[model samples]
Target: MSKIEKLLKKLCNPAYKQNVRKEELESILNHFFEGQWTFGEISGSHNYRIYHPYFKNFPEKFGPEGFLTIPVSGGKFIKHFYIKILCRFINEIKEIEK
Candidate 1:
């Protein structure tokens, strides 16, 4: 299994399903931002760009498409973008739930 699969499994584990404090969430993001953490598609050597492309114009071509991404630097470095987008998406979702 890939690291992302492992991470997703671990994250989905019922044991970790609890309210995450604001500080805790910030700490996790900060850790990754500071290059102190490494997991899945995120790394310290690349620049990532994230996009939330709107497919409302063509719903048939794309269904409920929310996010799109591309890497401008660090070829073959998709993890950086994945981590960035994932973290941002999670934080946003949490905020909405709160």
Candidate 2:
């Protein structure tokens, strides 16, 4: 498994679920997708829209169809579950390549 796979595996693990640093998740995402963060329609929410054409059909086309719920801890931390949707897509892409 690749490093991303490993990390995603860890992130997606139910038993290991924990709050993640928002910036850390974004850094990992920046490595795989082209996107930027914007405030979401939901109050205190944010969305990371993927612009990379190759990723348009990601995660069985669930691609970029969600928003990140508000971060916790003064807005520096986010629940991994909220962003699990994002990682699922990124992982699906990685899995398909293999």
Candidate 3:
């Protein structure tokens, strides 16, 4: 009935899955860094580190290369972070449905 609910319903549709793929993720990151973006202003604005502990220790283990590594600390944290954000977003969508 509300605008948020309507938007969320659209996002929940299976057709939008393709937009959430890895390539789309990479494109978003690239666009963000290229534009010198910051946090706390996006649609899914949450402290990802709070939900994922590995992100907290990333800088210590990999230094500059930590974020670039895959399936380790950085990669795992990113994967988990994205999932959490997506879920949270979906929940918001559900709330709008109500």
How close to the true structure is residue 4 of candidate 1, measured as C-alpha lDDT? 40
| Alpha-carbon RMSD to native, per candidate | 13.4, 4.9, 11.7
In model 1, state the lDDT of residue 71: 35
Q: After best superposition, candidate 1 residue 14: deviation in angstroms?
A: 28
Q: How many clashes (backbone atoms < 3 Å, residues ≥3 apart in a chain or on different chains) does model 1 have?
A: 3
Give lDDT per model, in order.
0.40, 0.60, 0.38
- Candidate 1: tens digits of C-alpha lDDT, residues 1-98: 75544554444454554433333333444433344223335665333322233323344543455323333323342333344445545455457558
Give the alpha carbon lDDT tens digit for every residue of 1-98 in model 3.
Answer: 75544544454455444233344333433432234323334464432212122323456643533232222133223344443444454365347558
Indicate whether candidate 1 or candidate 2 has the larger TM-score: 2
Worst 10-residue lDDT window, candidate 3: 47-56
Q: For each predicted model, how many residue pairs clash, with residues at least 3 apart or on different chains?
A: 3, 0, 0
- Give lDDT for model 1: 0.40
Task: Please report how far candidate 2 places residue 93 from its true position, in Å.
Answer: 1.3
Q: Give candidate 3's whole-model lDDT.
A: 0.38
